[model samples]
Target: MARITAGVGSSHVPLLGVAADTGKDADSYFGPIFEGYEWTRAWEREEKPDVVILVYNDHASAFDMKIIPTFAIGCGERYMPADEGWGPRAVPPVLGHPDLAWHIAQSLILDEFDMTIINEMEVDHGLTVPLTMMFGKPEAWPAKVIPLAVNVVTYPPPSGNRCWALGEAIARAVASFPEDLNVQIWGTGGMSHQLQSPRAGLINREWDNRFIDSLIGEGQEARQISHIEYLRETGTEGIEMVMWLVMRGALGARTRALHRHYHVPCSNTAIGHLVLLPDNGEQPGTDDDRALATT
Candidate 1:
Protein backbone atom coordinates (compact mmCIF):
# COMPACT_ATOMS: atom_id res chain seq x y z
CA MET A 1 0.00 0.00 0.00
CA ALA A 2 1.09 3.56 -0.68
CA ARG A 3 2.05 5.69 2.33
CA ILE A 4 2.96 9.34 2.72
CA THR A 5 6.68 9.28 3.35
CA ALA A 6 7.11 12.97 4.06
CA GLY A 7 5.96 16.57 3.52
CA VAL A 8 7.93 19.58 2.22
CA GLY A 9 6.88 23.19 2.62
CA SER A 10 8.72 26.01 0.82
CA SER A 11 8.39 29.56 -0.40
CA HIS A 12 8.12 29.87 -4.20
CA VAL A 13 9.26 33.29 -5.36
CA PRO A 14 10.01 33.81 -9.09
CA LEU A 15 13.08 35.99 -8.52
CA LEU A 16 14.66 33.14 -6.57
CA GLY A 17 14.57 31.11 -9.76
CA VAL A 18 16.21 33.92 -11.67
CA ALA A 19 18.90 34.23 -9.00
CA ALA A 20 19.66 30.54 -9.11
CA ASP A 21 19.54 30.40 -12.89
CA THR A 22 21.87 33.40 -13.21
CA GLY A 23 24.32 31.67 -10.87
CA LYS A 24 24.08 34.43 -8.27
CA ASP A 25 22.91 32.22 -5.40
CA ALA A 26 26.11 32.73 -3.43
CA ASP A 27 25.93 36.52 -3.77
CA SER A 28 25.46 38.44 -0.57
CA TYR A 29 21.82 39.18 -1.28
CA PHE A 30 20.93 35.61 -2.27
CA GLY A 31 23.41 33.54 -0.27
CA PRO A 32 21.22 33.32 2.80
CA ILE A 33 18.29 32.23 0.67
CA PHE A 34 20.14 29.43 -1.13
CA GLU A 35 21.94 28.37 2.01
CA GLY A 36 18.61 27.63 3.66
CA TYR A 37 17.99 24.74 1.26
CA GLU A 38 21.38 23.11 1.82
CA TRP A 39 20.02 20.97 4.62
CA THR A 40 17.08 19.88 2.45
CA ARG A 41 19.35 18.98 -0.46
CA ALA A 42 21.50 16.90 1.86
CA TRP A 43 18.43 15.26 3.37
CA GLU A 44 16.84 14.55 -0.06
CA ARG A 45 19.56 12.15 -1.18
CA GLU A 46 18.46 9.66 1.43
CA GLU A 47 14.73 10.48 1.52
CA LYS A 48 13.73 10.70 -2.12
CA PRO A 49 10.14 9.60 -2.75
CA ASP A 50 8.72 8.00 -5.87
CA VAL A 51 6.40 10.96 -6.50
CA VAL A 52 5.68 14.44 -5.23
CA ILE A 53 2.21 15.98 -4.90
CA LEU A 54 3.13 19.66 -5.41
CA VAL A 55 0.69 22.19 -3.97
CA TYR A 56 0.98 25.74 -5.37
CA ASN A 57 -1.09 28.69 -6.61
CA ASP A 58 -1.47 29.84 -10.20
CA HIS A 59 0.02 33.29 -10.74
CA ALA A 60 -2.32 34.16 -13.64
CA SER A 61 -0.26 31.97 -15.94
CA ALA A 62 -2.74 29.20 -16.71
CA PHE A 63 -6.05 30.51 -15.40
CA ASP A 64 -7.13 34.07 -15.99
CA MET A 65 -10.43 35.75 -15.07
CA LYS A 66 -12.15 33.26 -17.32
CA ILE A 67 -11.94 30.42 -14.79
CA ILE A 68 -10.49 29.75 -11.35
CA PRO A 69 -10.97 26.40 -9.73
CA THR A 70 -10.60 26.61 -5.95
CA PHE A 71 -8.64 23.36 -6.22
CA ALA A 72 -7.32 21.80 -9.43
CA ILE A 73 -5.39 18.61 -10.14
CA GLY A 74 -3.27 17.90 -13.22
CA CYS A 75 -3.95 14.42 -14.58
CA GLY A 76 -1.88 14.80 -17.72
CA GLU A 77 1.19 12.84 -18.78
CA ARG A 78 3.34 15.97 -19.02
CA TYR A 79 3.35 19.74 -18.41
CA MET A 80 5.46 22.42 -20.05
CA PRO A 81 6.94 25.39 -18.25
CA ALA A 82 4.83 28.55 -18.73
CA ASP A 83 6.09 31.97 -19.81
CA GLU A 84 4.95 34.29 -17.06
CA GLY A 85 5.48 37.83 -18.47
CA TRP A 86 9.24 37.74 -19.16
CA GLY A 87 9.81 34.17 -20.37
CA PRO A 88 9.67 30.56 -19.24
CA ARG A 89 12.51 29.51 -16.98
CA ALA A 90 15.16 27.35 -18.64
CA VAL A 91 14.02 24.10 -17.01
CA PRO A 92 13.06 20.62 -18.07
CA PRO A 93 9.40 19.85 -18.75
CA VAL A 94 7.57 18.20 -15.87
CA LEU A 95 6.65 14.51 -16.23
CA GLY A 96 3.36 13.57 -14.60
CA HIS A 97 1.98 10.41 -13.08
CA PRO A 98 -1.37 10.28 -14.86
CA ASP A 99 -2.45 7.02 -13.28
CA LEU A 100 -1.88 8.22 -9.74
CA ALA A 101 -3.28 11.68 -10.49
CA TRP A 102 -6.48 10.18 -11.89
CA HIS A 103 -6.82 7.95 -8.89
CA ILE A 104 -6.44 10.89 -6.51
CA ALA A 105 -8.93 12.97 -8.50
CA GLN A 106 -11.52 10.23 -8.42
CA SER A 107 -10.92 9.61 -4.76
CA LEU A 108 -11.18 13.30 -3.93
CA ILE A 109 -14.52 13.64 -5.68
CA LEU A 110 -15.92 10.62 -3.90
CA ASP A 111 -14.57 12.01 -0.66
CA GLU A 112 -16.66 15.19 -1.35
CA PHE A 113 -13.80 17.55 -2.32
CA ASP A 114 -14.75 18.48 -5.88
CA MET A 115 -11.57 19.28 -7.79
CA THR A 116 -11.18 20.81 -11.24
CA ILE A 117 -9.44 18.09 -13.20
CA ILE A 118 -7.05 19.30 -15.91
CA ASN A 119 -5.51 17.21 -18.65
CA GLU A 120 -3.69 20.22 -20.07
CA MET A 121 -2.13 23.38 -18.57
CA GLU A 122 1.15 25.32 -18.52
CA VAL A 123 2.92 25.40 -15.14
CA ASP A 124 4.17 28.74 -13.84
CA HIS A 125 7.07 29.75 -11.54
CA GLY A 126 4.88 29.12 -8.53
CA LEU A 127 5.33 25.42 -9.27
CA THR A 128 8.66 25.43 -11.06
CA VAL A 129 10.58 27.63 -8.60
CA PRO A 130 9.95 25.20 -5.76
CA LEU A 131 11.18 22.37 -7.98
CA THR A 132 14.24 24.40 -8.91
CA MET A 133 14.82 25.10 -5.25
CA MET A 134 14.53 21.53 -4.05
CA PHE A 135 15.65 19.40 -6.99
CA GLY A 136 17.78 21.96 -8.90
CA LYS A 137 17.99 21.99 -12.72
CA PRO A 138 18.18 18.30 -13.47
CA GLU A 139 18.02 16.99 -17.05
CA ALA A 140 14.85 15.35 -15.78
CA TRP A 141 13.27 15.57 -12.32
CA PRO A 142 14.45 12.74 -10.09
CA ALA A 143 10.80 11.82 -9.30
CA LYS A 144 7.46 12.10 -11.10
CA VAL A 145 5.06 14.82 -9.97
CA ILE A 146 1.33 15.44 -9.61
CA PRO A 147 0.53 19.16 -9.68
CA LEU A 148 -2.16 20.25 -7.23
CA ALA A 149 -2.98 23.91 -7.95
CA VAL A 150 -4.90 25.90 -5.38
CA ASN A 151 -6.66 29.24 -6.01
CA VAL A 152 -4.77 31.52 -3.65
CA VAL A 153 -4.38 34.41 -6.10
CA THR A 154 -8.03 35.36 -5.94
CA TYR A 155 -10.34 36.14 -3.09
CA PRO A 156 -12.42 33.39 -1.48
CA PRO A 157 -9.64 30.85 -1.78
CA PRO A 158 -10.10 27.61 0.11
CA SER A 159 -10.29 28.19 3.84
CA GLY A 160 -7.47 26.86 6.03
CA ASN A 161 -9.71 24.19 7.51
CA ARG A 162 -10.96 23.15 4.06
CA CYS A 163 -7.42 22.84 2.67
CA TRP A 164 -6.36 20.86 5.72
CA ALA A 165 -9.31 18.48 5.40
CA LEU A 166 -8.63 18.03 1.67
CA GLY A 167 -5.09 17.00 2.54
CA GLU A 168 -6.38 14.41 5.01
CA ALA A 169 -8.62 13.10 2.25
CA ILE A 170 -5.62 12.89 -0.11
CA ALA A 171 -3.66 10.95 2.52
CA ARG A 172 -6.51 8.44 2.67
CA ALA A 173 -6.61 8.19 -1.14
CA VAL A 174 -2.87 7.59 -1.35
CA ALA A 175 -3.01 4.85 1.29
CA SER A 176 -5.88 3.09 -0.49
CA PHE A 177 -3.95 2.87 -3.79
CA PRO A 178 -2.89 -0.74 -4.39
CA GLU A 179 0.53 0.09 -5.83
CA ASP A 180 3.57 0.27 -3.58
CA LEU A 181 4.50 3.90 -3.96
CA ASN A 182 6.45 6.36 -1.82
CA VAL A 183 4.56 9.65 -1.91
CA GLN A 184 5.56 13.11 -0.71
CA ILE A 185 3.20 16.08 -0.45
CA TRP A 186 4.95 19.43 -0.95
CA GLY A 187 3.21 22.72 -0.10
CA THR A 188 4.84 25.76 -1.72
CA GLY A 189 4.65 29.52 -1.12
CA GLY A 190 4.75 32.04 1.71
CA MET A 191 6.90 33.04 4.66
CA SER A 192 5.28 36.44 5.29
CA HIS A 193 6.07 38.70 2.37
CA GLN A 194 3.69 40.48 0.00
CA LEU A 195 4.32 41.44 -3.65
CA GLN A 196 1.49 43.78 -4.68
CA SER A 197 -0.01 47.12 -3.74
CA PRO A 198 1.86 49.46 -1.37
CA ARG A 199 2.19 46.56 1.04
CA ALA A 200 4.57 44.73 -1.28
CA GLY A 201 7.58 45.00 1.03
CA LEU A 202 5.97 43.57 4.13
CA ILE A 203 7.84 40.82 5.99
CA ASN A 204 6.70 39.49 9.34
CA ARG A 205 9.41 37.11 10.51
CA GLU A 206 7.97 36.77 13.99
CA TRP A 207 4.58 35.68 12.73
CA ASP A 208 6.13 33.52 10.05
CA ASN A 209 8.35 31.76 12.59
CA ARG A 210 5.39 31.23 14.87
CA PHE A 211 3.46 29.63 12.04
CA ILE A 212 6.49 27.45 11.28
CA ASP A 213 6.66 26.48 14.95
CA SER A 214 3.01 25.45 14.88
CA LEU A 215 3.56 23.48 11.67
CA ILE A 216 6.41 21.55 13.31
CA GLY A 217 4.26 20.92 16.35
CA GLU A 218 2.18 17.75 16.57
CA GLY A 219 -1.16 19.53 16.67
CA GLN A 220 -3.85 21.08 14.48
CA GLU A 221 -3.53 24.60 15.87
CA ALA A 222 -2.10 25.92 12.63
CA ARG A 223 -5.06 24.50 10.68
CA GLN A 224 -7.44 26.42 12.88
CA ILE A 225 -6.01 29.81 11.81
CA SER A 226 -8.54 31.87 9.84
CA HIS A 227 -7.98 33.45 6.43
CA ILE A 228 -8.78 36.87 7.79
CA GLU A 229 -6.04 36.50 10.37
CA TYR A 230 -3.55 35.42 7.73
CA LEU A 231 -4.46 38.39 5.57
CA ARG A 232 -4.56 40.94 8.35
CA GLU A 233 -1.36 39.87 10.06
CA THR A 234 0.71 38.10 7.42
CA GLY A 235 -0.01 40.62 4.61
CA THR A 236 -2.59 40.08 1.85
CA GLU A 237 -0.19 38.26 -0.41
CA GLY A 238 1.20 36.54 2.67
CA ILE A 239 -2.14 34.76 2.92
CA GLU A 240 -0.64 32.15 0.61
CA MET A 241 0.45 30.35 3.78
CA VAL A 242 -2.88 28.50 3.71
CA MET A 243 -1.41 26.06 1.20
CA TRP A 244 1.16 24.90 3.77
CA LEU A 245 -1.63 23.57 5.94
CA VAL A 246 -2.42 21.07 3.19
CA MET A 247 1.06 19.57 3.43
CA ARG A 248 0.88 19.58 7.20
CA GLY A 249 -2.51 17.83 7.34
CA ALA A 250 -1.49 15.14 4.86
CA LEU A 251 1.34 13.99 7.15
CA GLY A 252 -1.05 12.83 9.90
CA ALA A 253 -1.00 14.10 13.50
CA ARG A 254 2.66 13.41 14.28
CA THR A 255 5.90 14.21 12.43
CA ARG A 256 9.63 14.41 13.05
CA ALA A 257 11.10 17.52 11.46
CA LEU A 258 14.21 16.38 9.68
CA HIS A 259 15.36 19.79 8.48
CA ARG A 260 14.22 23.42 8.48
CA HIS A 261 15.55 26.66 6.99
CA TYR A 262 14.24 30.21 6.89
CA HIS A 263 15.76 33.32 5.31
CA VAL A 264 14.69 36.84 4.38
CA PRO A 265 14.63 39.11 1.29
CA CYS A 266 14.13 36.76 -1.59
CA SER A 267 13.15 39.59 -3.91
CA ASN A 268 9.86 40.53 -2.25
CA THR A 269 9.43 37.47 -0.07
CA ALA A 270 10.75 35.71 2.99
CA ILE A 271 11.82 32.20 2.04
CA GLY A 272 11.05 29.17 4.20
CA HIS A 273 11.63 25.45 3.64
CA LEU A 274 10.89 22.51 5.92
CA VAL A 275 11.30 18.74 5.64
CA LEU A 276 9.24 16.42 7.83
CA LEU A 277 9.20 12.66 8.31
CA PRO A 278 6.11 10.94 9.69
CA ASP A 279 6.72 9.56 13.20
CA ASN A 280 4.88 6.24 13.13
CA GLY A 281 7.94 4.02 13.62
CA GLU A 282 8.80 4.58 9.96
CA GLN A 283 12.50 4.99 9.24
CA PRO A 284 13.88 8.48 8.81
CA GLY A 285 15.04 9.36 5.29
CA THR A 286 18.72 9.76 6.12
CA ASP A 287 21.85 7.69 6.85
CA ASP A 288 22.37 9.67 10.06
CA ASP A 289 18.91 8.72 11.28
CA ARG A 290 19.65 5.08 10.54
CA ALA A 291 22.92 5.21 12.48
CA LEU A 292 21.17 6.82 15.46
CA ALA A 293 18.06 4.63 15.32
CA THR A 294 16.84 3.64 18.78
CA THR A 295 14.31 1.07 17.64
Candidate 2:
Protein backbone atom coordinates (compact mmCIF):
# COMPACT_ATOMS: atom_id res chain seq x y z
CA MET A 1 0.00 0.00 0.00
CA ALA A 2 1.07 3.59 -0.57
CA ARG A 3 2.25 5.16 2.69
CA ILE A 4 3.08 8.73 3.65
CA THR A 5 6.67 8.44 4.78
CA ALA A 6 7.30 12.01 5.90
CA GLY A 7 6.22 15.63 6.18
CA VAL A 8 8.29 18.73 5.34
CA GLY A 9 7.78 22.43 6.02
CA SER A 10 9.70 25.15 4.18
CA SER A 11 9.62 28.75 3.06
CA HIS A 12 9.33 29.45 -0.67
CA VAL A 13 11.10 32.74 -1.24
CA PRO A 14 11.53 33.75 -4.89
CA LEU A 15 14.79 35.55 -4.20
CA LEU A 16 16.19 32.34 -2.72
CA GLY A 17 15.67 30.66 -6.09
CA VAL A 18 17.16 33.68 -7.90
CA ALA A 19 20.24 33.47 -5.72
CA ALA A 20 20.64 29.76 -6.34
CA ASP A 21 20.10 30.05 -10.10
CA THR A 22 22.54 32.99 -10.38
CA GLY A 23 25.11 31.18 -8.16
CA LYS A 24 24.82 33.92 -5.51
CA ASP A 25 23.64 31.35 -2.98
CA ALA A 26 27.30 30.49 -2.45
CA ASP A 27 28.14 34.16 -1.67
CA SER A 28 28.31 35.56 1.86
CA TYR A 29 24.85 37.18 1.86
CA PHE A 30 22.90 34.13 0.64
CA GLY A 31 25.26 31.34 1.64
CA PRO A 32 23.67 30.71 5.03
CA ILE A 33 20.17 30.43 3.54
CA PHE A 34 21.28 27.81 1.03
CA GLU A 35 23.36 26.06 3.67
CA GLY A 36 20.25 25.73 5.83
CA TYR A 37 18.85 23.33 3.25
CA GLU A 38 22.09 21.35 2.90
CA TRP A 39 20.92 18.68 5.32
CA THR A 40 17.63 18.36 3.39
CA ARG A 41 19.47 17.94 0.09
CA ALA A 42 21.50 15.10 1.57
CA TRP A 43 18.42 13.66 3.30
CA GLU A 44 16.47 13.55 0.02
CA ARG A 45 19.25 11.57 -1.63
CA GLU A 46 19.04 9.08 1.23
CA GLU A 47 15.24 8.83 1.63
CA LYS A 48 14.00 9.31 -1.89
CA PRO A 49 10.19 9.38 -2.04
CA ASP A 50 8.47 8.13 -5.17
CA VAL A 51 6.11 11.11 -5.07
CA VAL A 52 5.80 14.42 -3.22
CA ILE A 53 2.40 15.88 -2.37
CA LEU A 54 3.44 19.55 -2.50
CA VAL A 55 1.15 21.98 -0.63
CA TYR A 56 1.72 25.63 -1.56
CA ASN A 57 -0.09 28.79 -2.60
CA ASP A 58 0.10 30.13 -6.13
CA HIS A 59 1.29 33.74 -6.00
CA ALA A 60 -0.97 35.00 -8.80
CA SER A 61 0.96 32.87 -11.25
CA ALA A 62 -1.69 30.26 -11.91
CA PHE A 63 -4.83 31.66 -10.34
CA ASP A 64 -5.42 35.40 -10.37
CA MET A 65 -8.30 37.57 -9.10
CA LYS A 66 -10.65 36.11 -11.64
CA ILE A 67 -10.78 32.56 -10.24
CA ILE A 68 -9.67 31.18 -6.90
CA PRO A 69 -10.38 27.87 -5.30
CA THR A 70 -9.77 27.55 -1.59
CA PHE A 71 -8.33 24.09 -2.30
CA ALA A 72 -7.08 23.04 -5.76
CA ILE A 73 -5.48 19.71 -6.62
CA GLY A 74 -3.42 19.26 -9.79
CA CYS A 75 -4.35 16.11 -11.75
CA GLY A 76 -2.39 17.01 -14.84
CA GLU A 77 0.19 14.89 -16.64
CA ARG A 78 2.79 17.69 -16.63
CA TYR A 79 3.21 21.25 -15.35
CA MET A 80 5.56 23.84 -16.86
CA PRO A 81 7.48 26.31 -14.73
CA ALA A 82 5.74 29.69 -14.68
CA ASP A 83 7.23 33.09 -15.54
CA GLU A 84 6.47 35.34 -12.59
CA GLY A 85 7.32 38.82 -13.99
CA TRP A 86 10.90 37.58 -14.53
CA GLY A 87 11.19 34.60 -16.84
CA PRO A 88 10.61 31.11 -15.46
CA ARG A 89 13.54 29.47 -13.73
CA ALA A 90 15.44 26.99 -15.92
CA VAL A 91 14.14 23.96 -14.01
CA PRO A 92 12.83 20.74 -15.46
CA PRO A 93 9.06 20.68 -15.90
CA VAL A 94 7.11 18.98 -13.12
CA LEU A 95 5.76 15.47 -13.81
CA GLY A 96 2.46 14.87 -12.04
CA HIS A 97 1.06 11.62 -10.65
CA PRO A 98 -2.28 11.97 -12.39
CA ASP A 99 -3.52 8.62 -11.14
CA LEU A 100 -2.78 9.36 -7.51
CA ALA A 101 -3.92 12.97 -7.86
CA TRP A 102 -7.26 11.93 -9.31
CA HIS A 103 -7.65 9.35 -6.57
CA ILE A 104 -6.98 11.92 -3.85
CA ALA A 105 -9.34 14.44 -5.42
CA GLN A 106 -12.13 11.88 -5.60
CA SER A 107 -11.49 10.78 -2.05
CA LEU A 108 -11.29 14.38 -0.74
CA ILE A 109 -14.61 15.28 -2.31
CA LEU A 110 -16.17 12.14 -0.82
CA ASP A 111 -14.58 13.06 2.50
CA GLU A 112 -16.55 16.32 2.26
CA PHE A 113 -13.54 18.51 1.54
CA ASP A 114 -14.48 20.43 -1.61
CA MET A 115 -11.45 20.49 -3.90
CA THR A 116 -11.07 22.20 -7.27
CA ILE A 117 -9.56 19.68 -9.66
CA ILE A 118 -7.09 21.30 -12.07
CA ASN A 119 -6.01 19.48 -15.24
CA GLU A 120 -3.56 22.05 -16.60
CA MET A 121 -1.57 24.86 -14.95
CA GLU A 122 1.87 26.43 -14.81
CA VAL A 123 3.57 26.13 -11.42
CA ASP A 124 5.05 29.29 -9.93
CA HIS A 125 7.86 29.99 -7.44
CA GLY A 126 5.61 28.83 -4.62
CA LEU A 127 6.01 25.23 -5.84
CA THR A 128 9.29 25.33 -7.84
CA VAL A 129 11.38 27.32 -5.33
CA PRO A 130 11.12 24.64 -2.65
CA LEU A 131 12.02 21.95 -5.21
CA THR A 132 15.14 23.98 -6.11
CA MET A 133 15.99 24.44 -2.44
CA MET A 134 15.82 20.69 -1.82
CA PHE A 135 16.99 19.14 -5.12
CA GLY A 136 19.18 22.00 -6.43
CA LYS A 137 19.61 22.33 -10.19
CA PRO A 138 18.81 18.86 -11.47
CA GLU A 139 18.03 17.58 -14.97
CA ALA A 140 14.57 16.63 -13.75
CA TRP A 141 12.91 16.40 -10.34
CA PRO A 142 13.85 12.99 -8.97
CA ALA A 143 10.25 12.14 -8.01
CA LYS A 144 6.75 12.52 -9.41
CA VAL A 145 4.68 15.37 -7.90
CA ILE A 146 1.08 16.00 -6.85
CA PRO A 147 0.59 19.78 -6.65
CA LEU A 148 -1.92 20.60 -3.89
CA ALA A 149 -2.57 24.35 -3.89
CA VAL A 150 -4.31 26.14 -1.02
CA ASN A 151 -5.63 29.69 -1.40
CA VAL A 152 -3.69 32.00 0.89
CA VAL A 153 -3.73 34.85 -1.64
CA THR A 154 -7.42 35.48 -1.08
CA TYR A 155 -8.42 36.91 2.27
CA PRO A 156 -10.12 34.61 4.78
CA PRO A 157 -8.57 31.52 3.25
CA PRO A 158 -9.45 28.17 4.82
CA SER A 159 -8.95 28.19 8.58
CA GLY A 160 -5.81 26.64 10.03
CA ASN A 161 -7.90 24.00 11.80
CA ARG A 162 -9.72 23.17 8.58
CA CYS A 163 -6.42 22.78 6.72
CA TRP A 164 -5.21 20.45 9.44
CA ALA A 165 -8.34 18.36 9.18
CA LEU A 166 -7.94 18.15 5.44
CA GLY A 167 -4.49 16.70 5.99
CA GLU A 168 -5.96 13.81 7.96
CA ALA A 169 -8.36 13.08 5.14
CA ILE A 170 -5.51 13.24 2.63
CA ALA A 171 -3.50 10.77 4.69
CA ARG A 172 -6.38 8.32 4.64
CA ALA A 173 -6.71 8.79 0.90
CA VAL A 174 -3.04 8.07 0.34
CA ALA A 175 -3.16 4.99 2.54
CA SER A 176 -6.12 3.48 0.70
CA PHE A 177 -4.22 3.45 -2.59
CA PRO A 178 -3.02 -0.09 -3.36
CA GLU A 179 0.10 1.06 -5.25
CA ASP A 180 3.38 0.21 -3.54
CA LEU A 181 4.91 3.64 -3.21
CA ASN A 182 6.59 5.86 -0.65
CA VAL A 183 5.03 9.32 -0.43
CA GLN A 184 5.94 12.58 1.31
CA ILE A 185 3.74 15.56 1.99
CA TRP A 186 5.39 18.99 1.97
CA GLY A 187 3.86 22.25 3.27
CA THR A 188 5.81 25.20 1.85
CA GLY A 189 5.82 28.97 2.54
CA GLY A 190 6.42 31.14 5.60
CA MET A 191 8.33 31.56 8.82
CA SER A 192 7.75 35.29 9.38
CA HIS A 193 7.90 38.02 6.76
CA GLN A 194 5.45 40.30 4.98
CA LEU A 195 6.06 41.25 1.33
CA GLN A 196 3.23 43.71 0.81
CA SER A 197 1.76 46.98 2.08
CA PRO A 198 3.96 49.50 3.97
CA ARG A 199 5.41 46.66 6.04
CA ALA A 200 7.02 45.01 3.05
CA GLY A 201 9.95 43.57 5.00
CA LEU A 202 8.63 42.81 8.48
CA ILE A 203 10.17 39.77 10.21
CA ASN A 204 10.12 38.30 13.72
CA ARG A 205 12.98 35.91 14.38
CA GLU A 206 11.95 35.29 17.98
CA TRP A 207 8.38 34.41 17.01
CA ASP A 208 9.58 32.29 14.09
CA ASN A 209 11.83 30.18 16.31
CA ARG A 210 9.14 29.88 18.97
CA PHE A 211 6.67 28.72 16.32
CA ILE A 212 9.12 26.09 15.15
CA ASP A 213 9.47 24.82 18.70
CA SER A 214 5.72 24.66 19.03
CA LEU A 215 5.50 22.81 15.75
CA ILE A 216 8.04 20.19 16.74
CA GLY A 217 7.11 19.74 20.40
CA GLU A 218 3.51 20.89 20.55
CA GLY A 219 1.90 20.24 17.16
CA GLN A 220 -1.60 19.65 18.57
CA GLU A 221 -1.38 23.02 20.29
CA ALA A 222 -0.30 24.61 17.01
CA ARG A 223 -3.61 23.63 15.46
CA GLN A 224 -5.59 25.64 18.02
CA ILE A 225 -3.60 28.76 17.13
CA SER A 226 -5.88 31.10 15.24
CA HIS A 227 -4.93 32.74 11.96
CA ILE A 228 -5.55 36.17 13.50
CA GLU A 229 -2.88 35.45 16.10
CA TYR A 230 -0.42 34.44 13.38
CA LEU A 231 -1.05 37.72 11.58
CA ARG A 232 -0.72 39.78 14.75
CA GLU A 233 2.38 38.01 16.06
CA THR A 234 4.27 37.01 12.93
CA GLY A 235 3.09 39.43 10.21
CA THR A 236 0.22 39.63 7.74
CA GLU A 237 2.03 37.29 5.38
CA GLY A 238 3.09 35.15 8.33
CA ILE A 239 -0.39 33.61 8.17
CA GLU A 240 1.09 31.33 5.55
CA MET A 241 2.46 29.20 8.37
CA VAL A 242 -0.97 27.59 8.76
CA MET A 243 -0.22 25.50 5.69
CA TRP A 244 2.47 23.76 7.72
CA LEU A 245 -0.28 22.50 10.00
CA VAL A 246 -1.64 20.49 7.08
CA MET A 247 1.64 18.63 6.77
CA ARG A 248 1.73 18.09 10.52
CA GLY A 249 -1.80 16.72 10.73
CA ALA A 250 -1.21 14.19 7.98
CA LEU A 251 1.58 12.54 9.97
CA GLY A 252 -0.82 11.78 12.87
CA ALA A 253 -0.33 12.86 16.49
CA ARG A 254 3.06 11.18 16.93
CA THR A 255 6.15 12.03 14.87
CA ARG A 256 9.89 12.33 15.33
CA ALA A 257 11.87 15.28 14.06
CA LEU A 258 14.45 13.87 11.69
CA HIS A 259 15.95 17.28 10.97
CA ARG A 260 15.22 20.98 11.29
CA HIS A 261 16.81 24.13 9.78
CA TYR A 262 16.03 27.79 10.35
CA HIS A 263 17.60 30.99 9.00
CA VAL A 264 16.53 34.62 8.81
CA PRO A 265 16.58 37.33 6.13
CA CYS A 266 16.31 35.03 3.12
CA SER A 267 15.59 38.15 1.13
CA ASN A 268 12.55 39.62 3.00
CA THR A 269 11.59 36.36 4.68
CA ALA A 270 12.81 34.05 7.43
CA ILE A 271 13.50 30.56 6.04
CA GLY A 272 12.46 27.47 7.99
CA HIS A 273 12.60 23.75 7.18
CA LEU A 274 11.68 20.55 9.01
CA VAL A 275 11.78 16.86 8.15
CA LEU A 276 9.47 14.71 10.26
CA LEU A 277 8.54 11.04 10.27
CA PRO A 278 5.67 9.28 11.97
CA ASP A 279 7.00 7.85 15.21
CA ASN A 280 4.46 5.06 15.69
CA GLY A 281 3.40 2.58 13.03
CA GLU A 282 -0.20 3.69 13.37
CA GLN A 283 -2.70 4.58 10.68
CA PRO A 284 -3.57 8.29 10.72
CA GLY A 285 -7.14 9.07 11.82
CA THR A 286 -9.83 9.08 9.19
CA ASP A 287 -12.84 11.36 8.53
CA ASP A 288 -14.95 9.02 10.65
CA ASP A 289 -12.19 8.98 13.27
CA ARG A 290 -12.00 12.80 13.32
CA ALA A 291 -8.82 13.79 15.14
CA LEU A 292 -10.52 17.15 15.48
CA ALA A 293 -14.17 16.23 15.54
CA THR A 294 -16.69 18.62 14.06
CA THR A 295 -19.62 19.26 16.30
Q: Which ranges in model 1 have alpha carbons more than 4 Å from their true place?
A: 281-295
Best by TM-score: 1
Number of clashing residue pairs in every model? 0, 0
lDDT of each: 0.86, 0.87
List TM-scores for all candidates, in order.
0.94, 0.93
Question: Looking at candidate 2, what is the lDDT of residue 98?
Answer: 93
RMSD of 1: 3.0
Which predicted model would earn the best lDDT?
2
Worst 10 residues of 1 by lDDT: 286-295
Those runs of model 2 whose alpha carbons end farther than 4 Å from true positions after fitting are 281-295
